[model samples]
Target chain A: MNTFLQLLNRVNSRVLFFGLLFVSLFLIVRNNEAQGKIFLNSAGRVTGFFGSGATAIGSYFNLRRENEKLQHEISVLRGQLAKDQYNTQVNIDTLQRVLDSTRIQIYKYIEATVVNNSVDKPKNYLTLNRGRHHGVKENMGVITADGVLGVVRYVSKYYCIVMSVLHTDSRVSAQIRGVDKGFYGSLVWRGKDPRFMQLIDIPKHNKISSKEDVVETTGFSTYYPPGVTIGKVFYHSIPPGSSNHLIQVKLNTNMANVRYAQIVVNVHADEINQLEARAKDEQ
Target chain B: MNSSSTLRISLKFIIIWILQIIVLKQVQFLPLGPYYYEAFVYPLFILLLPFGMHVNRLMLIAFFSGLLIDASYNTLGVHTASAVVLAFARPYILALVLPRGIDEAFTPSLGRLKFLPFLRYVIYAFLVYLPFYYTMVFFSHVFIVEIIVKSLLSFIVSVFFTLILAGILNGLD
Candidate 1:
């Protein structure tokens, strides 16, 4: 205790010098309004500078999570598009139509990240980080921004498996754009190239004049919306003695490296199915 | 430590303190834009304190003297903090400027050191004092340009007045 006191005694001048300085600084910050404001503002600026720097570095590590959040937001925005809504306005009269403008949202998109995907296999499938809880049902059409992916085959509580467009068994009803009422056919993969698909069963009687004819969804099935472009018609031929044309189509979406996809939820699917079932029962 | 010397020192302190508050405090030079600064000669008391005085005692005396000026100006700690810095630096500055073979009890005076050396000492002391004083006044480096301009301007006017005051005083010499 005595030695400690002696040690403190030797440094007492320094201690007092610093103590008085601290007191002066405290008084300046506490008493004078302008000086206090300057001090507080400068201190706040310093802390804020460091805080934003830390957030910048932390955000770099959080890119994947941030991407997922943005994807979800994009899905919500995609669902609100005018094309995604169904117009239920039956033309009773022009005046009545002006009074009644009813647009029902027929499709809601649920965004999902591709956890696993394969294009090299004969039967390719994609695993998505979405499930029944995310409103992804089996038979819901999966699509990217460019083209159709496949139908959702199976769904769990937290995940779903989608049959990719590159798969052998995958079939999509596709149409060719033309001036006349164009023809549509079942688009199928020929188990060879992942980038190309075969659109078959279009009757050769339909005039094929343009080389730039675009292959798109016919909207015949409940799987996809009308006019969703699947690909461009690359080549077509009437197989010997066959009445129908077999069209080779170049797919727009690159199936090998797809990272994100949206599951299309058709809201009136159950109603359409019931109506179709009644017609089948009558037959 | 004699009674007469003590009396003389006290009288000098009082005289300078009074002269600072009453006369120098009101002596406003024309404002040169935002670069205006006040003249301070109260620190001359700390500057001219006996060379043999302990640094700790010197600092305490300087602190109180500064506080007295602060009360009059309503700048409670700004002056005190600057004065304490001047008091703390006095010994080192004196060590640098004090001539060789000087007596141990030497107190700095105009008559003893004469004009040039005394001016040099005053310049060095104010060099330390004014910048620190302006720093305490402004309280932030955001006004760093203002601090430098004010310190330079105030240093010139202050040194001029302090030299004139020291020259007139007989007892201090």
Candidate 2:
């Protein structure tokens, strides 16, 4: 037992190092596939607690600009509401009221404050203050006033991590604005240039107008609503032997400075997904 | 260690941790172009721990502190692994730098090691820390060039900031 103790004592640090290293490696491997696990992701209580304190201090400096932006957003929303309002003329003493409850609401927005964000990495993520407790779920879309931000990839009680559009694997179905039934494509980030993204798979045969063409989400997927502006087309070129136009788009929302977002909750997502699954099984 | 000394060490950890997550993490030197990297002074917590502490205890301390930083950075195990490696390598590096063998109670600091030895110690520690960090971040041999290039760029800036921070917290000695 004394000799065994000597051996154990001799390699105690190495044993501990390898043991801890193994645990860390396990965390890295497990976390790579699913970022939603509460303990490993930033949405956990401990990380969120620290992130909130830091974000609070940082946001204090930008209050004026944030307020102005919110005010602008409110005005835009008000204009949209006015346009949708139906004006009815009353000829007699009968009162007319229009209840829009017949129109099923397909989308709901939950406002969230960004607790932590990073744009420099290959796979960037943003943490928001709202999470599972706030009706947030994995795969829901996140959007800013001007454009779409990302999809919620992980969630905990009071915080969640969004896989930002800046990530390499991020792909958003997008099309040119003002073009009904136009050819759509996928928007992808090339791991650089936070201000820009590449929209690919647009057929070369289609004519793209040069007048500051805007790109918007196609809403083909459950991730975003139809007609959400993504960016403006900056440049496009057709490579030799390729049948698609490589379009560069300048993003409207700056990924680095965005502090607030609204999570898009699709109420009919389950029905759509089930229908699609049945169709796939039939095929 | 006495209570006063323990309090001082705790204070150092708080200052360094805040400097790392709150200040340095947010300072993205965008002018550096694609080789973007954030400065890290939190490793100073492990480096500044009282000497003569067992390697087992030192590694454990480094592990926990790294987890704390990783929580804020959202990299999780990446920082923890790197910090542990640095902690394991630190004693050997210390022995190499100070060939004559030093006192057990002395904590490494700008004042304790003087200027030159202290600088060498910090450089060696970061050299181990940053490359391992970038490797874990990229996580594939396919990014070997990127790992090297990023490590070199980050090393220059991180070491500079760490020295400046060490100078400010010079009272630790």
Candidate 3:
């Protein structure tokens, strides 16, 4: 008894602190009103601020790793640039004025940093540093320098979240690289893997069959510029009695490692949207 | 142990409470940039209690003081929760900081513990209090990053004010 009292006496100052904490929590939970709600709202704002502060600290600690990543990224970009220049020049002679306009900037790329990103879930979203104030808006197609990613799902004044193409609802109009210009299909993800998406609705009779066929955005939609490399067709299957082939694609740009992305804002998006809206209205 | 020391603590409590409710309570960071938090030194009241004070008494005092602060700030129970926790952690902090634990008659003050030791102890206490306060306020695992960031930033600012106040009050001299 004396020993316990001795211990208690040693730590006596905090005797009631724990007891009160529970009772206080109980009061807080049970007796909340408008005042408590106001505090809650204020707390949300504070927590957001603090969360970013922690992120900044994490970034600071990860600066060395980030620097190494950038060095590797730059070297990769340099190699890709040489190849891209040659390819663009070779394709320019054979392509139409629409394709020519794409190279001449029908779409502008806004440089942005990935503030936050996720890819584990079925519906993965990424937050970009650009927002409504930075001319980013809802549905603006986002992509890395190498390939297509996803469209802007939501935007605030200074930040926006990208709904990655890995999501089930995300569908992009994509085409195989070849002689046939009109052979495009709706590309969709099967919600299984972040690294692969499936292109469905391609007519099985299209007869263009190849194992390593390259895929690119068709520019049939205003979301992505034409000829942005999406992935390579891994394999295709004619689903039993169905007339369409579902082609499995391996995405070129790894959605999980996307650090910096260029948000593709088609200058003609507004005009195209209006035209589409009017056509829908008439229908 | 003395009436004079108890009176001094009461006086310190009232002055700090008044300053907190009227002035420091309104001190919140600008809702801009990456970090947003409020630097609170009011929990220092619990930290300043005499070392040998019974835990039960200390916690009750902390609770009341926190409730009063909450009532004024329009955040009913937030300050209470934080204050009680700070009080609860005080003895443990003392035990951790002091190599010989705590003297039965020791009062946690700048005079007895010295400036640097006091600073270290107060900083540790603030770290514990601020993070808990923020966690309670946020109430979600999603804001985990925000809680940490806010706690760190708030720690720096709260420590600054706490040091200055500790220097001024000088505890039970």
Sorted by lDDT, highest first, which candidate order results? Answer: 2, 1, 3
The alpha-carbon RMSD over the true interface for every model, in angstroms, is 3.1, 5.3, 4.9
Better of 1 and 2 by DockQ: 1
lDDT of 1 by residue, B56-108 (tens): 77777788888888888888888888888888888888888888888768678
Q: What TM value does model 3 have?
A: 0.42
Candidate 2 docking band: incorrect
Q: What DockQ, between 0 and 1, does each candidate earn?
A: 0.22, 0.18, 0.22
Candidate number of the best TM-score? 1
Model 3, chain B only, scores a TM-score of 0.90
- Predicted candidate 1 versus true structure: per-residue lDDT over A1-283, tens digit per residue: 5574455446667777777777777777787788899988887687678876655777889999999999999988987999855333322232122322477667667777798999889999999888866667899898889899999999997789999888899899889976584778899998899899999989999877666788889888788888888888888899999999988999889888889887777888888989999999999
* Local accuracy of candidate 3 as per-residue lDDT tens digits, B60-128: 788898898878776678788988888777878888776465576767888778787888899889978
> If ranked by DockQ, best first, what sequence of candidates would result?
3, 1, 2
- Which residue segments of model 3 deviate by more than 4 Å? A1-18, A33-283, B30-34, B99-102
In candidate 2, stretches whose alpha carbon ends up further than 4 angstroms from where it belongs are: A1-11, A32-283, B99-101
Deviation in Å, model 1, residue A109 alpha carbon: 35
Of the two candidates 2 and 3, the one with more favorable DockQ, higher being better, is 3
Query: Estimated TM-score per prediction?
Result: 0.47, 0.43, 0.42
RMSD of each: 20.4, 30.8, 23.3
Which residue pairs in model 2 clash with each other? none
